[model samples]
Target: MTSSIVFDPLLPWPLLAVLAVIAALGVLLALWRGLPGWLLRALAAVVLVGALAQPSFQTEDRAPLSDIVLMLVDQSASQTLADRATDTEDAAQALAARIVARPNTELRRVDIGDGEDNTGTLAMAALNAALAEEPRARVAGIFMVSDGRVHDMLQAPDLPAPLHLLHTGRQGDWDRRLIVKSAPAFAILGEPVTLILRVEDDGAAPGDTLSEMRISIDGDTPQSFDVPIGEDIEIPVTLPHGGLNVIQFTLPEAAGELTDRNNTALVQINGVRDRLRVLLVSGEPHAGGRTWRNLLKSDSSVDLVHFTILRPPEKQDGVPVTELSLIAFPTRELFLEKIEDFDLIIFDRYKRRGILPAIYLDNVRNYVEQGGAVLIAAGPDFASADSIYRSPLSAILPAEPTARVIEEAFRPKVTDLGHRHPVTADLLGQETWGRWMRQIEVDPLEGEVVMTGVDDKPLLILDRVGEGRVAMMASDHAWLWSRGFEGGGPQLELLRRLAHWMMKEPELEEEALWAEPTGQTMRIIRRTLGDSVGQVTVTRPDGTEDQVQLEEVAPGRFEAVYEGPEIGLYRLAEGDQSAVVGLGPASPKEFEETIATGDALQPLIDSKRGGVVALQDGLPSIREVRDGRPAAGRGWLGITPRDAFETLDVTKTPLLPAWLVLLLASAMIVGAWLREGRS
Candidate 1:
């Protein structure tokens, strides 16, 4: 309770000043004229004026509020290194106990961990949130226990009080980090691609010598080499296959280092072929021959080898064989010598014309079984006895001709299976494709029928033999669609997808298992031609396996999303198909710099007249200081007292009552009159 005199004047202050002036004039007249009663009259006037000015005593009951001290504890990934976690916990508990024991003080404990969206340690954000929840006037000081590796120092809020840091980590803490300075997302297969990297030491490094680094491809045995410390080195890597290549680079752990998480780096580079080589064998010259040539030649990435048999050996013309314009077909070179060089082999209206010997046909069959691709476009000859399906290559063909040729116009339609097969799934303009005039009838002995012709007959069949793939197209009048026979279809795109699928492009595989990583989450997808697929077994970098069920979103397509608990390599396998992918980064931002220092936040601390002390030394003693003064010193941290209070009740009592002042003035007036009369 506190009391003070307060005025409640009956008249305006200007009016009271005029009354006071009259009283002073009276006193001056009495002094000048030697009148003894003048002093008494002046005293009465002063008492009258005082009665008009009311004075009251005001009392208030207030409760003092405790000063708030914000203590932010860093529990981020970096703080987990070495003994920093233990030190941070110990410092936080000790500080909390000290603040609680201090009179008129409150501790606002805030535990801050890893930040969202891969932003390292957002200690400032956590601190701001805690401050917003408390009364700003009562905030005394701000304290943090961390390694000083905050990534969001620029977002630090304006301090209402002193800010200090109780730093974690040790003096001689060192760390060796592998930094991939530059890496390409794509590289041509069979060619060397360069990856620029750097190896450097931080803190109190042991030596300035070369370090031995090991590199491996697709989990192969790692090869070790020496790399100069603190220098960027260029590593040239050649991909073995035309697909995604996983390369791992690691540096052997040095003694007295912070962690080994930053020692290994995983790089995923897509390998692509330089060009696609295609072998197109046309049994005879036809209108569709140019169409095949046009499609293959239009793509700059394709190298086409075309052969057209203008005449057979049985056909004798007036001109001799040497005089004819047709050149000898290179059957030996193309079919036997360099068969593996071709990525795809297309047979357009090919028949048993005796031009290719039986042994050559057998070699073509062997080619398909040895990881080759073949596409057969059949015509009327396919239904005849001389059909190529009747040759030695028939064993590898997907279908057998029934010796019946359908000669009616019918639109090609995708079967139910086609909607699921990657080769024909979601084909452009598939529902509005033009009609073909002729389609050779055939029976599918093995493989998937993707498209149907007239009477629901198989128009397209796709199959796999040994390590190769085969696709059979039963119509020769597909060229009509190219000429806009009924509104041109997506022929170009359809043929392009077919060629790529046949060539075993990883993206076009019917049965594929792959993962798409976005941040720390990976969406695992499995595509198959079958109606159903089994659960995918995921093996994390720690060699722990988990079976995740996939929900079918479309026909024969199953998918599931997984949030990775840690950063590193993850392997996904479904049946015999498997894929390896990397989530997040090889070296996370938290582990980039593990040594604890307050250099990042020193400026902010200094601006608020605060200081930083290492927990390794000892817990600092808490003290109180004035605002704008140094709030921290050797072995001590200080807080400022706000001296704030909340008023509960107030009372006002009149210091001098009006009646008593009036009575006193009247008595003095009467006494002055009697004195004047006597004088």
Candidate 2:
């Protein structure tokens, strides 16, 4: 309980002040004139002034609130390194017991986990959130039990009290981290991609010397070499394929390092073709020939080299060949000299034309075997004696000509195998496709028949020979789809998929395993032509293995979601297919700097007059300290007691009564007058 005198003036403060001034002036005048009993007159004036300015004795009823101590415990990924987890939990429990035991003190404990999206430990965010839940006046101290590697120091809130850190880990603890200083999201195929990387040793590093760096591309055998620590190393790599490439770098863990998590880094660099060079060999000027030309010309990245045999050797035109307006075919230059330069070769209604000799056709066969792509769009000539099957390419052709061409209109239908093949799988709006006027009949020898026409005859065949791919379309009416005959189908998408699949794009692989990350959970996807895919064996970054059973979501498509406990590379494998995907950022903020220290946060700690005590020494005791003073010592952490209170009720009593004031003023005036008259 507290009591004090408060005044309620009858008039404004300025008016009351003027009245008091006048009364004091009268007393002074009486004294200056040598009036008898001047002190009694001054007393009466003072009593009247006091009565006009009403004063009351005010008292309050208050109950003291307990001082609040906020303790934030770090449960981020970095805390799981070494013995920091044990140290943090033990210190938090100890601090909680001590704060609860203290008289007139409350403990506000908050356990913070890894920040969303591998943002690392947001200690300041956690601390501020915890503070906001408690009364600011009652908050007396703040404590952080962590490894002191806070990522959000700039987010520190206005400190209502001192902040202390119970640092985890040891003084001699060290860590070796692989830093990808620079990496490109996409690199041109066949060009050397330069990567700026650095390997660093932090804290009490073991012997400042070189460390071995291992590099692996697309799950290949790792190649290693000794690289100097704390120095940038530029690694130039030429990608093997034109698709997404997974490149990983690792530094072998040292004996006393903090963690191996930072020792490895995964980077996914997409290998893009600088220019898609396509060789189009047309047999004659045909209506469907421009469809292939138009499709290839649509993409600016594709360089189309169209060679048409407009003038065959058997032409008997009297006009001189040199005076012809059409551009002469450079058969030798394209078929012999620069044939290997093209990524794909398209034969649109092409036959066994005399323009390309048997040797050039043989070279095309060899080209397909040596990682090249070929797409044959057959016309009516394919069912004749002059078919490409009669050339040296017959050895690699997936089907043989039956010398029969069906002229009846028929709608193209995907085979059962085509529904699983990446090239034709899930073709959007395939049911709305129009009919083609003709399809050449053929007998399948090898490869998979993905599409059929009337009488279930093979219309499309896709196969692999050596390291290359071949696609044979038995019909030349695909242009009908592009022209929107009846209702157009997904011609563009189908063409794109077919071209990319022939180019051996990883995404179009019929049998493959891959994953994509959504936050910390990995969506594992398996694509195959088989009925079922076995459980995928996932090898975590920590070298732990887990068998994940996938549920089939669509035909030949299996998927399963795995919530990763750590943010790093997870290698998934199903049978002969395997892939590596990073569940989070390659270098997560959690493991960037795993050493336990407060150097980065010294300014924040100093502003709060806090101290950093290592758990390696011992868990310190709690002590009370005055505000605006240092609150930490070698053996203890100090918390100031706020001594806050709330007023339940307030009572006010008048200090002076009106009757008493009137009586006192009259007596003083009478005495002063009597004294003056007697004198």
Candidate 3:
């Protein structure tokens, strides 16, 4: 309980001030006039004013509130290095015991770990959250047990009391980490790209040292080379394939190092072809010949080599050969000499001609079987005896043509498999395709049918032979859609995808598995030609396996989202196709500086008149001090006593009762009047 003098005035303060001033003036006049009983009148006026003031003795039923000391404990990934975790736990327990032993003091323990993402230690954020919960007046001080490697210092809250840090690690600790200073996201295939990297040592670095740096691509055998420490080295790397390339750079571990987590770094880059070399051979001139030429020529990335047979060798024209404006086809050079150099080979409405002998056709078939791509666009001539199928190339062709050619207006339709195949899947406006006037009747012998013509006959077929791929289009009137003969469709899109698929682009693969990472979450995707897919088994960097089921989002596509527990490389496999993806970084931010120091948090502690002590020395004793006094010493941390109380009830007793004041005032007046009348 507590007691104090408080006032409950009977009237407004302004009015009371005016009345007091008037009474003072009246007393002065009475004194000047030598008035009898003037003392009594002054006393009566004092008693009346005191009663109106209504001063009272107020008593409160009080309850003392315990002071709160916020303790922020860091348990982030970095704290796990060496004996930091054990040291922190020991110090925290000792501090808790001391605080609990103090009278009217409570400990608010806030355990801080890794951040929401891969961000390093967030000790300041945890401190702010803990402070927000408790009353500011009751917060005595803040105590932190950490390595002092805080990432968010700008969010530090204004201190209500002294802030002290108990540093966790020893002074002689050291670590070495690899840093990729600069790298490109994409590089042209078969071309050397430069990468800048550095090997850095933090805390107690050796004076002079040479380290062996090992490099690898896609889990290949590592190649090692000696590099000087504490300097940037430029490395020239050439990608092996045309897709996502994973390159890893690592340095050998050093003696007495804190950790090897930051020794290796991985960089992912996409490999793209500088130019697409396409060999286009047309057997004869047709209305759609210019369409193919125009499409290939429009793309700046394509290098088109077009040849048209305007005159057959057997045709007897009236004009001499010298006058004819036609050059001899380069079949020998293209089919044998530089066949593998071309990315794709296209035969537009081609037929068996004397220009290309049987030996040249056999070489073309061999080219397609040895990791080369071929696309055949057939016309009515495919059904005749002059068809290229009569040559040795028929062995690899996806379809065999019948002797009949259908010349009717029929709209092209996508087959059920086409809806799932990446090359034809989700083609714009596929349901409403323009009509084609001519198509060669064919039976698929070795590939999947993606598009059909009249009476559900195969119009487009795709297949993989040996190590190469092949695509065949049976209709010649596909250009009619580009001419807007009826409502135009995605003719250009369909042809572009078909060409890319033939080039074995990874995105157009029939069966593929890959993952995309956003922060710590990964979206695993599976593309297949089959209706149903099995569960994907994931292998983490630590060699742990997890089986995840996939949900069908489209006809041939399945996907699942997974949040990784740690940061590192992850391998995914479904059936025969497998992919590897890296999440976060090869080295997380927390491990960048494993050796702990108080340099990061010293300024924050100094701002609040606090000190930092290492737990290696010993845990400090807790002490109570005034708010503005020094709160930290060589071996002690301090907390300010709030002396806070909560009031349960209040009782008021007026100093001067109304009845007593009235009786005293009346007697004083009567005496003043009687004395003045006698004088």
Which residue runs does candidate 1 get wrong by more than 4 Å? 1-65, 279-300, 303-341, 350-369, 384-395, 427-434, 479-490, 531-535, 550-553, 644-679
lDDT of 2: 0.88
Candidate 1 structure quality by residue, lDDT tens digits, 429-546: 7667887889989999999999899998999999999899999999998789789988867677778888998999888888888888887899999999888889899888899999
RMSD of each: 7.6, 4.4, 5.0
Q: Residue-wise lDDT of candidate 3 within 527-621, one digit each (tens)? A: 99898899999988789999999999999999999888766677888999888777777568898777777788878888778888989889888
TM-score of each: 0.78, 0.86, 0.82
Report the number of clashing residue pairs per model.
0, 0, 0
Ranking by lDDT: 1, 2, 3
lDDT agreement with native, every candidate: 0.89, 0.88, 0.88
lDDT of 2 by residue, 1-679 (tens): 9999999989898988999999999999999999988999999988988898999999999998999999988888889988788888988898899889999988888998888866788888888888888889999998988888888888988899988988897988888899999999999999999999998888898776799989888778999999998889999999887666888888887887888888888888888889989998889988788888898899898899998887887886799867889888887888789989999999988888687889999999999999999999999989888999899888888999899989999989989999989888888666779899999999998899999998999999999988898989999899999999999777788888898788777789999888887766889999999999899999987899999999999888999999887766778888999887777788988899988888877788888698999988988898999998899988998998899999999999987789889899999999999999999
Badly placed stretches (over 4 Å) of model 2 are 6-56, 93-98, 518-520, 540-545, 563-570, 582-584, 616-623, 633-636, 654-679
Best by TM-score: 2
Evaluate model 1: give its lDDT: 0.89
